[model samples]
Target: MLRARVELRELARDWRSWCKAIAEAAEKTLGSSRVYVFGSAAEGYATGGSDVDVLVVAGRLPRSFRLRGEIKARIEEEAGLPLYHPFEIHLATWKEAEANPIYREAIEKGKIINAQGLDSMKPIGESFGESRGRLPDRSLGQR
Candidate 1:
Protein backbone atom coordinates (compact mmCIF):
# COMPACT_ATOMS: atom_id res chain seq x y z
CA MET A 1 0.00 0.00 0.00
CA LEU A 2 2.78 2.42 0.89
CA ARG A 3 4.62 1.57 -2.30
CA ALA A 4 1.47 2.14 -4.37
CA ARG A 5 0.92 5.53 -2.74
CA VAL A 6 4.50 6.56 -3.39
CA GLU A 7 4.20 5.57 -7.05
CA LEU A 8 1.00 7.55 -7.40
CA ARG A 9 2.59 10.63 -5.88
CA GLU A 10 5.56 10.34 -8.24
CA LEU A 11 3.25 9.99 -11.17
CA ALA A 12 1.36 13.13 -10.21
CA ARG A 13 4.58 15.10 -9.84
CA ASP A 14 5.80 13.86 -13.21
CA TRP A 15 2.55 14.82 -14.87
CA ARG A 16 2.75 18.36 -13.51
CA SER A 17 6.38 18.68 -14.58
CA TRP A 18 5.48 17.52 -18.07
CA CYS A 19 2.71 20.08 -18.30
CA LYS A 20 5.02 22.87 -17.21
CA ALA A 21 7.72 21.76 -19.61
CA ILE A 22 5.28 21.61 -22.48
CA ALA A 23 4.07 25.14 -21.69
CA GLU A 24 7.62 26.40 -21.57
CA ALA A 25 8.53 24.70 -24.82
CA ALA A 26 5.52 26.16 -26.57
CA GLU A 27 6.39 29.61 -25.29
CA LYS A 28 9.96 29.30 -26.52
CA THR A 29 9.05 28.04 -29.97
CA LEU A 30 5.81 29.89 -30.63
CA GLY A 31 6.97 33.38 -29.63
CA SER A 32 4.88 36.42 -28.70
CA SER A 33 1.59 34.59 -28.25
CA ARG A 34 -0.80 34.15 -25.36
CA VAL A 35 -0.53 30.59 -23.99
CA TYR A 36 -3.26 29.35 -21.71
CA VAL A 37 -4.01 26.22 -19.72
CA PHE A 38 -7.69 25.52 -20.00
CA GLY A 39 -10.12 22.65 -19.36
CA SER A 40 -9.64 20.40 -16.33
CA ALA A 41 -6.10 21.49 -15.46
CA ALA A 42 -7.02 25.15 -15.59
CA GLU A 43 -10.06 24.65 -13.38
CA GLY A 44 -8.16 22.78 -10.66
CA TYR A 45 -10.19 19.64 -11.36
CA ALA A 46 -7.57 17.55 -13.06
CA THR A 47 -7.06 13.94 -12.09
CA GLY A 48 -4.65 11.25 -13.26
CA GLY A 49 -5.75 11.40 -16.88
CA SER A 50 -6.18 14.99 -17.97
CA ASP A 51 -4.42 16.03 -21.14
CA VAL A 52 -2.80 19.44 -21.16
CA ASP A 53 -4.88 21.85 -23.21
CA VAL A 54 -3.01 24.83 -24.63
CA LEU A 55 -4.46 27.70 -26.61
CA VAL A 56 -2.07 29.67 -28.80
CA VAL A 57 -3.22 33.01 -30.15
CA ALA A 58 -0.81 35.00 -32.25
CA GLY A 59 0.36 35.19 -35.84
CA ARG A 60 -0.36 32.05 -37.82
CA LEU A 61 2.30 29.43 -38.10
CA PRO A 62 4.15 29.00 -41.37
CA ARG A 63 2.85 26.44 -43.83
CA SER A 64 5.87 24.23 -43.26
CA PHE A 65 5.27 23.96 -39.55
CA ARG A 66 3.09 21.34 -37.89
CA LEU A 67 3.06 23.26 -34.63
CA ARG A 68 0.84 21.04 -32.55
CA GLY A 69 2.47 17.78 -33.53
CA GLU A 70 5.92 19.22 -33.08
CA ILE A 71 5.11 20.50 -29.63
CA LYS A 72 3.61 17.19 -28.64
CA ALA A 73 6.63 15.26 -29.81
CA ARG A 74 9.03 17.57 -28.06
CA ILE A 75 7.16 17.33 -24.81
CA GLU A 76 6.99 13.57 -25.00
CA GLU A 77 10.67 13.29 -25.72
CA GLU A 78 11.80 15.82 -23.13
CA ALA A 79 9.56 14.66 -20.36
CA GLY A 80 10.21 10.95 -20.99
CA LEU A 81 6.60 10.39 -20.09
CA PRO A 82 3.51 9.65 -22.13
CA LEU A 83 1.48 12.08 -20.09
CA TYR A 84 0.13 14.10 -23.00
CA HIS A 85 -2.40 12.41 -25.18
CA PRO A 86 -4.38 13.86 -28.07
CA PHE A 87 -4.23 17.44 -26.84
CA GLU A 88 -6.16 20.39 -28.22
CA ILE A 89 -4.32 23.29 -29.81
CA HIS A 90 -6.51 26.20 -30.85
CA LEU A 91 -4.44 28.53 -33.01
CA ALA A 92 -5.54 31.95 -34.17
CA THR A 93 -4.23 35.38 -34.94
CA TRP A 94 -4.33 37.89 -32.14
CA LYS A 95 -6.94 39.96 -33.91
CA GLU A 96 -9.04 36.89 -34.65
CA ALA A 97 -8.88 35.79 -31.05
CA GLU A 98 -9.94 39.19 -29.78
CA ALA A 99 -12.85 39.28 -32.19
CA ASN A 100 -14.22 35.86 -31.28
CA PRO A 101 -16.76 35.82 -28.45
CA ILE A 102 -15.75 32.27 -27.49
CA TYR A 103 -12.18 33.39 -27.15
CA ARG A 104 -13.23 36.31 -25.01
CA GLU A 105 -15.32 34.00 -22.89
CA ALA A 106 -12.44 31.57 -22.52
CA ILE A 107 -10.13 34.36 -21.58
CA GLU A 108 -12.66 35.47 -19.03
CA LYS A 109 -12.73 31.95 -17.59
CA GLY A 110 -9.48 30.22 -18.58
CA LYS A 111 -6.20 30.25 -16.71
CA ILE A 112 -3.50 32.28 -18.41
CA ILE A 113 -0.12 30.91 -17.45
CA ASN A 114 1.94 32.87 -19.97
CA ALA A 115 -0.09 35.71 -21.34
CA GLN A 116 2.48 37.23 -23.70
CA GLY A 117 0.53 39.82 -25.64
CA LEU A 118 -2.17 40.16 -23.02
CA ASP A 119 -1.68 42.33 -19.96
CA SER A 120 -1.71 39.72 -17.20
CA MET A 121 -1.96 35.96 -16.75
CA LYS A 122 -4.19 36.08 -13.73
CA PRO A 123 -7.39 34.04 -13.72
CA ILE A 124 -10.58 36.01 -14.27
CA GLY A 125 -12.80 34.91 -11.39
CA GLU A 126 -15.81 37.14 -11.96
CA SER A 127 -19.13 35.44 -11.38
CA PHE A 128 -21.74 35.54 -14.15
CA GLY A 129 -24.22 37.29 -11.87
CA GLU A 130 -21.64 39.91 -10.98
CA SER A 131 -20.65 40.51 -14.58
CA ARG A 132 -24.19 40.86 -15.84
CA GLY A 133 -27.46 41.07 -13.92
CA ARG A 134 -28.33 39.19 -10.78
CA LEU A 135 -29.24 35.55 -11.23
CA PRO A 136 -32.36 34.12 -9.62
CA ASP A 137 -31.68 31.81 -6.71
CA ARG A 138 -32.79 28.45 -7.98
CA SER A 139 -32.40 26.68 -4.63
CA LEU A 140 -34.37 29.31 -2.72
CA GLY A 141 -37.76 28.25 -4.23
CA GLN A 142 -37.80 31.55 -6.12
CA ARG A 143 -37.17 32.26 -9.75
Candidate 2:
Protein backbone atom coordinates (compact mmCIF):
# COMPACT_ATOMS: atom_id res chain seq x y z
CA MET A 1 0.00 0.00 0.00
CA LEU A 2 1.15 3.56 -0.69
CA ARG A 3 0.62 4.62 2.91
CA ALA A 4 3.00 2.00 4.20
CA ARG A 5 5.80 3.11 1.91
CA VAL A 6 5.39 6.82 2.54
CA GLU A 7 5.20 6.37 6.27
CA LEU A 8 8.28 4.16 6.40
CA ARG A 9 10.23 6.47 4.09
CA GLU A 10 9.44 9.39 6.33
CA LEU A 11 10.66 7.39 9.32
CA ALA A 12 13.80 6.40 7.48
CA ARG A 13 14.55 10.04 6.79
CA ASP A 14 13.68 11.17 10.30
CA TRP A 15 13.42 8.35 12.87
CA ARG A 16 15.74 5.76 11.38
CA SER A 17 18.49 6.42 13.87
CA TRP A 18 16.13 5.95 16.76
CA CYS A 19 14.69 2.84 15.13
CA LYS A 20 18.14 1.34 14.75
CA ALA A 21 18.80 2.14 18.35
CA ILE A 22 15.74 0.17 19.25
CA ALA A 23 16.77 -2.66 16.96
CA GLU A 24 20.11 -2.83 18.73
CA ALA A 25 18.29 -3.22 21.96
CA ALA A 26 16.10 -5.86 20.41
CA GLU A 27 19.04 -7.83 19.11
CA LYS A 28 20.87 -7.61 22.39
CA THR A 29 17.93 -8.38 24.59
CA LEU A 30 15.34 -10.05 22.42
CA GLY A 31 17.79 -12.20 20.47
CA SER A 32 16.48 -10.75 17.23
CA SER A 33 18.36 -11.37 14.00
CA ARG A 34 16.22 -9.31 11.62
CA VAL A 35 13.63 -6.55 11.40
CA TYR A 36 10.94 -5.56 8.89
CA VAL A 37 8.25 -2.96 8.42
CA PHE A 38 4.66 -3.94 7.68
CA GLY A 39 1.09 -2.63 7.75
CA SER A 40 0.40 0.96 6.70
CA ALA A 41 4.07 1.77 6.68
CA ALA A 42 4.66 -0.98 4.16
CA GLU A 43 1.54 -0.22 2.13
CA GLY A 44 2.83 3.25 1.10
CA TYR A 45 -0.20 5.42 1.87
CA ALA A 46 0.46 6.62 5.37
CA THR A 47 -0.39 10.16 6.40
CA GLY A 48 0.92 12.42 9.12
CA GLY A 49 0.95 10.77 12.56
CA SER A 50 0.96 7.26 11.11
CA ASP A 51 2.39 4.74 13.54
CA VAL A 52 5.32 2.54 12.54
CA ASP A 53 4.88 -1.24 12.70
CA VAL A 54 8.02 -3.38 12.59
CA LEU A 55 8.71 -7.06 13.05
CA VAL A 56 11.67 -8.64 14.83
CA VAL A 57 12.64 -12.26 14.31
CA ALA A 58 14.89 -14.13 16.69
CA GLY A 59 15.14 -16.43 19.65
CA ARG A 60 12.94 -15.90 22.63
CA LEU A 61 13.63 -12.93 24.89
CA PRO A 62 13.76 -12.48 28.61
CA ARG A 63 10.71 -10.92 30.15
CA SER A 64 12.51 -8.06 31.84
CA PHE A 65 13.48 -5.90 28.85
CA ARG A 66 11.03 -3.56 27.17
CA LEU A 67 11.97 -1.30 24.21
CA ARG A 68 8.86 0.73 23.49
CA GLY A 69 8.86 3.33 26.26
CA GLU A 70 12.59 3.76 26.67
CA ILE A 71 13.38 3.96 22.97
CA LYS A 72 10.45 6.26 22.31
CA ALA A 73 11.46 8.59 25.10
CA ARG A 74 15.04 8.77 23.94
CA ILE A 75 14.04 9.26 20.32
CA GLU A 76 11.64 12.01 21.25
CA GLU A 77 14.32 13.66 23.34
CA GLU A 78 16.95 13.45 20.65
CA ALA A 79 14.59 14.75 17.98
CA GLY A 80 13.29 17.52 20.25
CA LEU A 81 9.83 16.74 18.94
CA PRO A 82 7.51 13.90 19.78
CA LEU A 83 6.93 11.52 16.92
CA TYR A 84 3.50 11.94 15.42
CA HIS A 85 3.15 8.15 15.40
CA PRO A 86 3.92 5.58 18.05
CA PHE A 87 6.63 2.99 17.44
CA GLU A 88 5.02 -0.44 17.32
CA ILE A 89 7.76 -3.05 17.33
CA HIS A 90 6.72 -6.69 17.17
CA LEU A 91 8.95 -9.43 18.59
CA ALA A 92 8.75 -12.92 17.10
CA THR A 93 10.92 -15.84 16.08
CA TRP A 94 11.52 -17.58 12.77
CA LYS A 95 9.45 -20.44 14.05
CA GLU A 96 6.65 -18.09 14.95
CA ALA A 97 6.83 -16.38 11.60
CA GLU A 98 6.36 -19.73 10.01
CA ALA A 99 3.79 -21.03 12.43
CA ASN A 100 1.72 -17.93 12.97
CA PRO A 101 -0.51 -17.13 10.02
CA ILE A 102 -0.69 -13.43 10.75
CA TYR A 103 3.04 -13.00 11.08
CA ARG A 104 3.49 -14.89 7.83
CA GLU A 105 1.07 -12.55 6.07
CA ALA A 106 2.90 -9.52 7.41
CA ILE A 107 6.18 -10.86 6.08
CA GLU A 108 4.59 -11.51 2.74
CA LYS A 109 3.42 -7.90 2.47
CA GLY A 110 6.11 -6.11 4.47
CA LYS A 111 9.22 -4.32 3.41
CA ILE A 112 12.51 -5.39 4.89
CA ILE A 113 14.53 -2.67 6.54
CA ASN A 114 18.28 -2.52 6.93
CA ALA A 115 18.63 -1.86 10.60
CA GLN A 116 20.41 -2.96 13.74
CA GLY A 117 18.73 -6.30 14.09
CA LEU A 118 20.10 -7.39 10.74
CA ASP A 119 21.48 -5.70 7.66
CA SER A 120 20.24 -8.35 5.27
CA MET A 121 16.66 -9.58 4.95
CA LYS A 122 15.03 -12.56 3.38
CA PRO A 123 12.43 -12.37 0.65
CA ILE A 124 8.76 -13.16 1.30
CA GLY A 125 5.56 -13.56 -0.63
CA GLU A 126 3.45 -10.64 -1.87
CA SER A 127 -0.07 -11.93 -1.34
CA PHE A 128 -1.83 -12.27 1.99
CA GLY A 129 -3.55 -15.61 2.41
CA GLU A 130 -7.31 -15.36 2.56
CA SER A 131 -7.50 -16.58 6.14
CA ARG A 132 -4.83 -14.08 7.14
CA GLY A 133 -5.87 -10.71 5.84
CA ARG A 134 -4.52 -7.41 7.16
CA LEU A 135 -4.74 -7.13 10.89
CA PRO A 136 -5.80 -4.17 13.00
CA ASP A 137 -4.82 -0.64 12.02
CA ARG A 138 -3.78 0.31 15.54
CA SER A 139 -0.82 -2.07 15.68
CA LEU A 140 0.08 -4.95 13.40
CA GLY A 141 2.76 -5.82 15.89
CA GLN A 142 0.25 -6.05 18.66
CA ARG A 143 -1.65 -8.90 17.04
Candidate 3:
Protein backbone atom coordinates (compact mmCIF):
# COMPACT_ATOMS: atom_id res chain seq x y z
CA MET A 1 0.00 0.00 0.00
CA LEU A 2 2.87 2.37 0.77
CA ARG A 3 4.44 1.49 -2.56
CA ALA A 4 1.13 2.13 -4.25
CA ARG A 5 1.01 5.65 -2.82
CA VAL A 6 4.49 6.41 -4.10
CA GLU A 7 3.56 5.09 -7.50
CA LEU A 8 0.40 7.18 -7.55
CA ARG A 9 2.33 10.33 -6.80
CA GLU A 10 4.80 9.55 -9.54
CA LEU A 11 2.02 8.86 -12.01
CA ALA A 12 0.34 12.14 -11.20
CA ARG A 13 3.55 14.07 -11.70
CA ASP A 14 4.32 12.24 -14.89
CA TRP A 15 0.82 12.87 -16.20
CA ARG A 16 1.26 16.60 -15.78
CA SER A 17 4.68 16.56 -17.38
CA TRP A 18 3.59 14.39 -20.26
CA CYS A 19 0.62 16.61 -20.99
CA LYS A 20 2.87 19.67 -21.00
CA ALA A 21 5.41 17.91 -23.20
CA ILE A 22 2.77 16.81 -25.66
CA ALA A 23 1.39 20.31 -25.87
CA GLU A 24 4.83 21.75 -26.50
CA ALA A 25 5.62 19.10 -29.08
CA ALA A 26 2.29 19.55 -30.79
CA GLU A 27 2.83 23.27 -30.96
CA LYS A 28 6.17 22.72 -32.62
CA THR A 29 5.04 20.02 -35.04
CA LEU A 30 1.38 20.56 -35.77
CA GLY A 31 1.47 24.38 -35.48
CA SER A 32 -2.28 24.85 -35.81
CA SER A 33 -4.10 22.35 -33.65
CA ARG A 34 -5.34 21.82 -30.12
CA VAL A 35 -4.05 19.38 -27.49
CA TYR A 36 -6.31 17.98 -24.79
CA VAL A 37 -6.14 15.61 -21.84
CA PHE A 38 -8.86 12.99 -21.84
CA GLY A 39 -9.83 9.49 -20.65
CA SER A 40 -9.08 8.57 -17.03
CA ALA A 41 -6.92 11.56 -16.42
CA ALA A 42 -9.56 13.97 -17.59
CA GLU A 43 -12.29 12.19 -15.69
CA GLY A 44 -10.30 12.15 -12.42
CA TYR A 45 -10.11 8.34 -12.31
CA ALA A 46 -6.38 8.03 -12.93
CA THR A 47 -4.41 5.71 -10.67
CA GLY A 48 -0.78 4.79 -10.08
CA GLY A 49 -0.51 2.81 -13.31
CA SER A 50 -2.83 4.78 -15.50
CA ASP A 51 -1.59 5.72 -18.92
CA VAL A 52 -1.69 9.28 -20.15
CA ASP A 53 -4.44 9.59 -22.73
CA VAL A 54 -4.76 12.54 -25.08
CA LEU A 55 -6.50 13.61 -28.23
CA VAL A 56 -4.93 15.70 -30.92
CA VAL A 57 -7.71 17.43 -32.79
CA ALA A 58 -6.58 19.02 -35.98
CA GLY A 59 -8.03 20.21 -39.22
CA ARG A 60 -5.83 17.72 -41.03
CA LEU A 61 -3.71 14.76 -40.05
CA PRO A 62 -0.03 15.41 -39.75
CA ARG A 63 1.87 14.98 -42.97
CA SER A 64 4.48 12.88 -41.17
CA PHE A 65 3.26 9.80 -39.38
CA ARG A 66 6.88 9.32 -38.43
CA LEU A 67 6.80 12.62 -36.63
CA ARG A 68 3.72 11.55 -34.70
CA GLY A 69 5.41 8.27 -33.80
CA GLU A 70 8.52 10.08 -32.70
CA ILE A 71 6.51 12.40 -30.49
CA LYS A 72 4.69 9.48 -28.84
CA ALA A 73 7.91 7.52 -28.40
CA ARG A 74 9.62 10.47 -26.79
CA ILE A 75 6.70 10.96 -24.40
CA GLU A 76 6.89 7.31 -23.36
CA GLU A 77 10.63 7.48 -22.90
CA GLU A 78 10.45 10.70 -21.00
CA ALA A 79 7.53 9.65 -18.82
CA GLY A 80 8.88 6.12 -18.27
CA LEU A 81 5.39 4.78 -18.80
CA PRO A 82 3.79 2.91 -21.65
CA LEU A 83 1.13 5.03 -23.28
CA TYR A 84 -2.48 4.15 -22.60
CA HIS A 85 -2.79 0.87 -24.52
CA PRO A 86 -3.91 1.51 -28.07
CA PHE A 87 -3.27 5.21 -27.70
CA GLU A 88 -5.64 7.11 -29.90
CA ILE A 89 -4.94 9.83 -32.41
CA HIS A 90 -8.25 11.19 -33.53
CA LEU A 91 -7.61 13.19 -36.68
CA ALA A 92 -10.57 15.32 -37.56
CA THR A 93 -11.71 18.83 -38.22
CA TRP A 94 -13.31 20.89 -35.48
CA LYS A 95 -16.52 20.56 -37.39
CA GLU A 96 -16.28 16.79 -37.27
CA ALA A 97 -15.99 16.82 -33.50
CA GLU A 98 -18.92 19.18 -33.29
CA ALA A 99 -21.05 16.76 -35.28
CA ASN A 100 -20.02 13.51 -33.57
CA PRO A 101 -21.62 12.68 -30.22
CA ILE A 102 -18.70 10.58 -28.97
CA TYR A 103 -16.11 13.16 -29.94
CA ARG A 104 -18.20 15.87 -28.35
CA GLU A 105 -18.28 13.93 -25.10
CA ALA A 106 -14.53 13.57 -25.04
CA ILE A 107 -14.00 17.24 -25.71
CA GLU A 108 -16.45 18.11 -22.98
CA LYS A 109 -14.41 16.21 -20.41
CA GLY A 110 -11.06 17.22 -21.86
CA LYS A 111 -8.93 19.98 -20.47
CA ILE A 112 -7.15 22.07 -23.00
CA ILE A 113 -3.45 22.49 -22.41
CA ASN A 114 -3.11 24.57 -25.48
CA ALA A 115 -5.77 26.19 -27.61
CA GLN A 116 -3.98 27.32 -30.75
CA GLY A 117 -6.47 26.37 -33.43
CA LEU A 118 -9.20 28.28 -31.66
CA ASP A 119 -9.21 30.85 -28.90
CA SER A 120 -10.53 28.27 -26.48
CA MET A 121 -11.93 24.75 -26.47
CA LYS A 122 -15.63 24.66 -25.79
CA PRO A 123 -17.91 21.76 -24.98
CA ILE A 124 -20.66 21.49 -27.54
CA GLY A 125 -23.29 20.32 -25.00
CA GLU A 126 -23.61 18.62 -21.65
CA SER A 127 -20.93 16.03 -21.02
CA PHE A 128 -22.16 12.46 -20.61
CA GLY A 129 -21.33 10.05 -17.79
CA GLU A 130 -19.32 6.94 -18.51
CA SER A 131 -21.75 4.22 -19.44
CA ARG A 132 -22.82 2.41 -16.26
CA GLY A 133 -22.88 -0.87 -18.14
CA ARG A 134 -19.16 -0.64 -18.86
CA LEU A 135 -17.55 0.10 -15.47
CA PRO A 136 -18.27 -1.76 -12.27
CA ASP A 137 -19.97 0.34 -9.61
CA ARG A 138 -17.55 -0.77 -6.89
CA SER A 139 -14.54 0.42 -8.86
CA LEU A 140 -15.91 3.95 -8.92
CA GLY A 141 -15.52 4.20 -5.17
CA GLN A 142 -12.23 2.31 -4.98
CA ARG A 143 -10.32 5.36 -6.04
lDDT-best of 1 and 3? 3
TM-score of 3: 0.53
lDDT of each: 0.53, 0.54, 0.54
Consecutive 10-residue window with the lowest summed lDDT within model 3: 134-143
| Highest TM-score model number | 3
Give the per-residue lDDT digits (tens) of candidate 1, residues 8-106.
Answer: 555553544444555565566665555555677667777764555666655656444586567546645653544424345566555555687766555
**Which 10-residue window in model 1 sums to the lowest lDDT?**
127-136
Error of 2 at 131 (Å): 20
* TM-score winner, 1 or 3: 3
Indicate the residue-level lDDT of 5 in model 2.
64
Question: Given candidate 1, what's the lDDT at residue 34?
Answer: 54
lDDT of 3 by residue, 41-73 (tens): 767787766655676666555457786677656
Provide TM-scores for the models. Answer: 0.52, 0.52, 0.53
